[model samples]
Target: MSNVLYEVRDGIAIITLNRPEKLNALSIELGHELAAAWERFQSGPERAAILTAAGDRAFSVGADLTDPPEIWPFAPGVGVHVDKPVVAAVNGLCVGGAFILVQFCDLCVMSETATFVYPEAKIGLTGGLITSLAARMPHKLAMEFMMVGEPMTAQRAYEAGLVNQITAPDALMDAAMDYATKLAGLAPMVLSTIKRHVAEVLPKGPSEKAGIARRDLQAVRESDDFREGTTAFREKRPPQFKGK
Candidate 1:
């Protein structure tokens, strides 16, 4: 079965993390699939997107340690260039890398059973993307969560402005979809302009900036022109290049 599921309805894209048995862990494969899903949503006709997961256990238990993913590629504004709105519908145990995913979303709604945690400091490993949380919310609160490595309940997260709304488990999807649908009806150019401006003003973490740079490098490295240049050099001739 696919680790991610993508669907479009009512001008909104529904992207589901589909590994409930593993608590939707952000494994290496899942990260690539999720990144592709986001790219698809950005290039498609959908005006807004709702990100959610299967099962009641967790949105994700974060990374799969034994087979960790290079998560930056899936993070919004880092590797995925999405200007359309993205809404996170979180339920239960949103941990570590997972919280960063929610943190980058335009809006979020959580189930009463939901909780967010970032245990990287205690785990002795970190991607440093969590530092961007300070820009998204209060500095002290962000520091407390990342440093203390404690679970922040949905109520607390809502209070701290990390989540837009909290509802029953069954209502989580409804809440997220509501936000997506409303956003879908708004002026696309207006919404994109506001999103671009906010991204410009917002501070990014070290790893996030690195991810964007890496994505740019990866594009050029994979381009046909790069291959042509290398081949021409080997053949002792001038390279023909296409800017694409």
Candidate 2:
């Protein structure tokens, strides 16, 4: 079965991450498929898009540790230019790279059980996700997530204005679709123009901010601490990070 699935109906493109057993973890193939799916949505007749995942366990548990994807270590929407609105239907445990998607979506509908987390600090790397989160959320809250690496519950996300709506797990898709349909009903050209204008007026989009992030993250990746962190994670032991 395909790791990513895409379909369009009633002017809304629906994209689903299909790896439920792994909590929809993004492997290399899945990341490429997801990027392609988004491109298809943008080029197709769809006026809006809904991004979701199969299964009740997770929207995505983030990147697959066993074999990470070569794509940007952030949300697909971050570096890509998609003029149409996109809504995220977060079901459960959304963490690491997955949290980037939640941050970039135009609207977000999260399941009551869903949680958002950024564990980059724990892994000894940082950049794009941090930059994007700071842009979308309040400074203090973004710092808490990036620095502490704690999970934020759906209620907290909603209260913080990070998500548009929160609902029972069973109602997540319905709520997301409702928002996407509303967006699709608007005048397409006007909607696209407004989206473009907003992006232009914003201080920076992910693509614009990514260059610095990539450089900084590359430096981190070369650090002995990064090696220690990954090695410890794989060996199931606490990382003994030394300031190196």
Candidate 3:
């Protein structure tokens, strides 16, 4: 079976991450397959896409840590540039790279049991992707999720205006598909144009970074701070990030 599954029902394209055993981790193969699937969906008869997972457990546990994908990472429908909407059906833990994926979606329906977090700090990685889209979320909330490395429940995510809807696990896909279908029923050209305008004009991140932050990130990435952060996490200790 394919790691990435794509099927069209009515005018909605349902894209499922088929690796339930691994919590639908995005491997290199899955990433490339997903990219291809997104392309097909954009050009195919489907008017919109509903992204989900195979199991009841997870929408996606994010990128595979043991064997990470390439530099680009696994961004659902990323780079496909589909004009139609893409709605996320988050069923469970949406962490790390997966959190970033949901941020880029036009809309999202998160299961009651779902949680979102950007815990790259625990793994010696940075939230480059999340940072790129941080402007979509509230400044303080986004910073808390990234800096603290704590998972935010679906309800909290919705409260923070991060998730579009919160639904029971059994109804997660249904809710997402309903939204996608409804979006598909609209005038495709107009919807496409509106989405383009928002995407092009929206603020993805800070326009100009403070010189201190830039220097800090540079020094941290190269210095012992980053490594110490990861090591501290693995050892279950708090990280002492020195600005140096």
TM-score (all chains, Cα) for each model: 0.96, 0.81, 0.80
Q: Write down the lDDT of every candidate, Cα atoms only.
A: 0.91, 0.81, 0.78
Ordered by lDDT, highest first, the candidates read 1, 2, 3
Compare candidates 1 and 2 on lDDT and give the better one.
1
Instruction: Give the worst 10-residue stretch by lDDT in candidate 1.
Output: 70-79
Per-residue alpha-carbon lDDT of model 2 for 42-105, expressed as tens digits?
Answer: 7788899999999998899888889776445335445455788999999989978777766777
Candidate 1: tens digits of C-alpha lDDT, residues 1-244: 9999999888789999999999999999999999999999988999999999999989999999988987789987787889999999999899989888988899999999989999998889998888888998899998999999999999999899998999999988888889998999999999999999998899988888898899889989999999999999999999999986
Cα deviation at 67, candidate 2, in Å, is 1.3
Ranking by TM-score: 1, 2, 3
Give lDDT: candidate 3, residue 12.
Answer: 86
Q: Which candidate leads the pack in TM-score?
A: 1
Q: What lDDT, from 0 to 1, does candidate 1 have?
A: 0.91
Clashing pairs in 2: none
Candidate 2 lowest-lDDT run of ten: 70-79
Per-residue error (Å), model 3, residue 216: 31
TM-score between candidate 3 and the true structure: 0.80
